[model samples]
Target: MSFIQSLKSSLKASLGSKQRQVSAVPQIAAKASENPDLEKLLVIPVSDDPKEEQQRSHAFNKGQFLARQERWEDLSKIVNDEDQNRRASGGGMPIAELLCQGARADVVALAEHLLIDGTPEEARPLSEAISALEQILGEHSNNHVIATIVAMAHLDIAWAWRGTDAVRDTPARNLEAFELHCTRACQVLDPFCGIELDSPLVTSARCALLVGTPNAQTRVADDYEDLIDLAPEQQRHIRALGHHMLPQWFGSYETLELEARRTAARTQDIWGAGAYTWTYFDAVLVDPYCARYIDIPFFLEGIRDILERSEDQHNANLFASFAAVSIPNAAHLCADDLESCSALEQIQTAAQWIMSDYLHELHPLIWGHAMEGFDNHARIASIDALFKQGREKANQVFVRIFGEQMRKGNALIFTPQGLYVQQA
Candidate 1:
């Protein structure tokens, strides 16, 4: 039997409850036959028809969509084909000229794909992506999306080369380049209302470039305060991200947790699974350096309370519980065996264990999506049935089926657009 099927069988045997009529559930299984990297969650859907002049702008969006999905190979193929086609038609396409979303998708795809791969050959493509983005910005300096994307590309290039032999030769120069991109992005984004703390562009850039800098704690906290008016879900995401980012810049754990409590209190959704905040929260706990300051069990107990009070709970709660149960022991394991205990390895192992033991009794569809290497779903059931089974088992299921998913390689890519963005 499949994982969930087996779990149901066990439940019937143990509880002696009559067989409940099972129903179909919305399956969150990603593309089964493909590697997780090619999967996407399209966030900003584009119109099918576009004016000739609108094509270039649309191309950028399409590229971003592909990039978010992490479809690197497809993106590369499309970019190459478009470049060849454009050359055959008329080789003199100006960088400043806006292409339809179709054309822009090629350039955006190249830039983002290079960001995740981190190959030495990526240098040329990174430069090309920036140049194209710059051209777009030159003509449309006020365009926040273009400016933000340009900044993201710059940061990605910098991240791709960090600690590399080439960049190590003059690290300061490389950092300066990143700062320049940030400055450029902020020039366009800062003038817009609610972009500083709210924009993915600004928040992500700050986390990447500014996190380790001096006095980042104060600035990040201030940003949180400004974001209070946003919906609780957004606030939780930003705050949780802040929790992860602040400590690197010397933010106090006590202070950070205090803020987190306040944010938690504001949320009507007790489990806080509405966003990917739990991932960030779990990430903090997994850090050995971070564990010294946190009261692991205490922190988890609070989460447990949220889960208990949560109206509609799911696998996220179980994932959180699994982390709470497994992380401390995992940390000890890592401390004992440094070779095996890399942060990514810790998360991967935790996920595997959760699949095998905790949610292992549940459906592959319920927690299979939660596991790292496993993608193919064995079955699907009703959302209500999943919840019912989850309640019976004192577990729940969650759908983190979209938004930016980071792979084990430490490469981050945004998923394709969906009704629910995970805010990763």
Candidate 2:
């Protein structure tokens, strides 16, 4: 059988005995191409040039392979090496962080399936895999690296049990399982929280664990403060804090504004006002009501600050993805709240300058999420559609922004190093 057919069959079989066909996520909506400008320029597509994605995936790939092979010691060595000395890839991302994330791929996939399908897998497959890691941890009780991995696995299992809908959407039984795993994740990770055992993964895990705690609202800022300080360069943590600051998660609009500014002040040396920009980046998109709370001038300045500080293509692509896909998409998601809608429009207009000035290369996976409203979890049916969605989004944006140049037969070719004009 063909790979897609085999995949579909196996996935269907894994959904338990309900007999209703199910998938990891909902089906992708067919978007008809309507832009006459879409054909104006030649584009460097994500699937066609996967080297950028591969650069980020190598650590995750290596880590998962070792894990599936039961090469626990080898995995431990990679973690330890990174823990002792954090290493950055050519794109300036911390390799150890990706390794830590990839280590839990097995359990995370199960949890993700549960989150998207809204059905419980009967065999409790993640339990068996987690137990193996726990056994390995028992043999090396002092290995905080393995403990971090174990803690992360429990966290993934916890989220799977809870699922990704509103609290009201989940059944009581699922909530019970979620709490049980979350509490265990907290306990397992307790030892690594000590002063001497300081690590970014541990800090991040703690920030995530706040969701399970009763005091998430009160402690969210403090936990994130420690994390951003510990890893100043990782603006993702700052981005997360903004989402958490929303009233639905941990804080109100007032609190979000305060925290964004406070974070900007604290990380000024590293991110400048860029910290404030990152903090508000996802907030407006995730919670449109929070848009008015953002400082418009400061936010734009930070966008410039971020690109000015880094020549690496990865950072550039981040803003590019946001400008090309995220803000434009956010504008359509607005139903009411004219004030919030107006704020999103402002950002959307600003996105043009980003496509024109800063964006040099593209990252397909990043753009994929950007195209799909930045919901990292599944919503699209086909796994392959992720990159395809990004390419289409990028093409549409390029055509609109560079239509004049393209109409004159100048095609823009993007590379990891720079953008080139191909004379036609």
TM-score of each: 0.46, 0.83
- Give the Å error, residue 157, model 1: 2.6
Best by TM-score: 2
Residues 1-424, candidate 1: write the lDDT tens digits: 2222332343333334333333354443333323333234222212222232144345555565654454434544554344323221111121121222332344433433443333444356445445645665565566444454455455444443343221135557556755565555455455544444344323434444443345655576555544433323232344345445444444655665555555554553534432223423543543444544444444444444444443222343345334533454445644764543454244433443333222212222223222221111223245445444333222221222221242232222222221222433
**CA-lDDT, candidates in order:** 0.39, 0.70
Looking at model 2, residue 141 earns an lDDT score of 85
lDDT of 2 by residue, 1-424 (tens): 3222333344454555543333443233533255443444555543434444575588888877776666778888887677556455644456776787777776566555545554454335444545666776787788777777878788777777776543448878878888888888888887787235657767777887888888788789988998777777777778889988888888999999999999999888887789888888878777677887777889888988887787555656667778656876676666577777777677766666665566665666667677656676545645466666666666666766666777787877665444567787
lDDT of 1 at 245: 44
lDDT of candidate 1 at residue 369, scale 0 to 100: 26
Model 1's TM-score against the true structure: 0.46
On a 0 to 100 scale, what is the lDDT of residue 211 in model 2? 81
Error of 2 at 392 (Å): 1.6
Location of the lowest summed lDDT over 10 successive residues in candidate 1: 88-97
